[model samples]
Target: MRFYQATRFLFPGSLRLRMLALCSVGTHIPLLALAGWQLATGRADWPSLGLVIGATLVGTLFTLLCIDALLAPVRIATRAVAALEREQTAALTAVRDGDLLAELVVGVNRATEATKVRIATLDDAAHRDPLTGLLNRRGFLTRTEAARDGTVALIDLDRFKAVNDQFGHDAGDAILQDFAAYLARGVRRSDCVARWGGEEFAVFFPETEEGEAAGILHRIVRRMGAGLIDRPDGSPVTCSGGVVALDGETIGQAMTRADAALYAAKRAGRNQLRVSDAHIRLD
Candidate 1:
């Protein structure tokens, strides 16, 4: 048995076939040897030897077939478990009234469903903003770790504090929610936007050139200006942003440059976009 286990890799077939081969070799070889001894000692006739050999073959084949049938449910359970590992949402199909193995399948299916729900809830909590339903900073970093040749921007709402002070925190919350929705709707499906913290946000335009990113950001801001939660004066809500091509820089370095450019935008005039050079203008 140990030798068989050690060399299992050399035997290439389904588990059922391998098990059947081992069982046949273990049981049939001794019985055939005993029959040969009996015949040599004149205790059994050749015709009786033939009958014994035939009966042994028939009995082994039938028993092995039943065993293979019994293993089918175990195989199904194994495959279902593997699928769950590969895909978080995977589940097992329902099994009707059955024996102990069938009950096991049903139990596994129920367990899989429970695990799926728990995982979904945990994932959302880990990666999502509770109030705005946007991806949080950690999520943004995790999802875009392998990104290349894209543009990243740091954006700030101009006069966000003034809005909070004048309208009360509830109204301020409304504005934030409105802003998050606007960002979600305005960006292309391929772009990722995150609520970096407070009134600051981050955006990534993957595989985008600096010029193209500039245009997309401007458009998004322009639309956001008119659509956000209303101010009593009805002046459009505006934002200042700084965008930088990822180029060869780490995201942290690019964000540093972008932050500098953001402050530059805030200093120059509240509502505009700036580029990485700190000296370059994106008017």
Candidate 2:
């Protein structure tokens, strides 16, 4: 490494230059010794010495050309690491086996896989609400960006501030976790639920009609009213929701209507669901 660093001034990113330098020094040292010995024994000849020098130069050039092929594994690993550092890609595998540097390649392959998993874990954490173990708003939006054809809802726990004020934030946090779990259980694996900040949550049902989505939300509301989880005030935990369809709109576009409908449910009394009138109706 030190040798490469020094030689890099003359030939940037050329490890072969260093290798050729070493090879020339190694090959010529013996030649120097032989030449000195022959001269001391009165056997020195210019023709023979020139021939030896020509052969050494040709051999060194050939060796340098051949060695680059043998360094394929190193190049592969280098590129993989570079890509990973930039967070451009993931899920790497060994390019091949049975190379001279197969062990290096295999090690790099394992390292890349491990790195990808760690990166995924960190990304998940960044997008999650730690208290509820559900996707946070950012995660929700990221995951549903491509899922434009779906049904979605925005839900807010009714009078949740009363619980936080009366029982303290710890108890409030517990209620939120319970609410998140209940929502998760109510939805299918293909569905998504996220904590949309404070006591609000978001749900997405991909490729679903508003009617089916409404039915699902209604059942959840019914169960929640039955005290699936109670508030710190010993009253039934209830919520209000606004369901909207994404027939030809993005999640962001639907969120406006869903939020409006959610507020409408909150106004008309909580523990109910509403939809955009003259729009997709789950009623």
Candidate 3:
């Protein structure tokens, strides 16, 4: 019976029904032929013919019942596939012992579950910054490195600790957010800018030299120092920066040298821009 149901999958459902009906007639013809031979040999009576008809009817009914039982699995499979198409997480719940169709449905459900989990993992790996959505340190590094040959600058906001010390961490956060926005707009689209870390920001100029980067930084310092950031009491905000060219050892090394110059700027005055001396690389 199980084998017959498994074979039914190879045929259309309507054709399967017609085939089963034909099987019933085929089964009856052989029995009728045997009964006719017995009556012809004078070894059977009309009563024998009646017995043959009854047996055929009973056997046909039994075969049809078995076929219907086997079909239960097919019906369950069709419905389960429909649910899977609609819900994406549907599983086979009507499995019977010794049913191959039931096993196939269970396997499909397992594959679907695994696929959903993998997709979610990939999605998480894409958009999120490995460090912080505050833009990862790597993302900033890649963008700055790709900029056309130009001057690069690093800026540090002065006296940033006073906010954290006097007003608490909340005020420090607000200040950072405000400063980040201000810095973003201060540079040109051709330039790259990023928040390096607490109170420090870096800028890159495409197709520019140290002199050009220094000039831009000086203008920005004066603008910011002249009370560019609005506050309740109008106390001025000041920044110090260092500018350098890309013609040195490496981008990282150039940044390190720029930091030294930035320290020099901060030591000289609260608001200033200092350009680092150019260093020629042998390699």
By TM-score, the best candidate is: 2
Under the 3 Å rule for N, CA and C atoms, how many clashes does model 1 have?
A: 0
Candidate 3's TM-score: 0.53
Error of 1 at 147 (Å): 1.1
Ranking by lDDT: 2, 1, 3
Return the TM-score for each candidate structure: 0.64, 0.64, 0.53
Clashing pairs in 2: none
In candidate 1, what are the lDDT values of residues 1-283, reduced to their tens digit? Answer: 4664454553333455565677677668967797878878979777877877787778778878998888887868766754555544443443323333444555576667778788899997899888889889888887777786799998888898888888788877877888888887777899998998899988888898877888887886776666555664576678889988897877767778888888898998867888866535666
Better of 2 and 3 by TM-score: 2
Q: Give each model's whole-structure lDDT.
A: 0.76, 0.80, 0.67
Error of 2 at 237 (Å): 0.8
- Candidate 1: list runs displaced more than 4 Å: 1-94, 224-229
* lDDT score, candidate 3, position 126: 51
Q: After superposition, how far is residue 8 of candidate 3 from its true place, in Å?
A: 18
lDDT of 2: 0.80
The root-mean-square deviation over C-alpha atoms between each candidate and the true structure, in angstroms, is 8.5, 9.4, 9.7
Query: Mind giving the per-residue lDDT tens digits that candidate 2 earns over 90-177?
Result: 4334333332233344456666676788989999999999999999999999999988788999989999999989999999999999
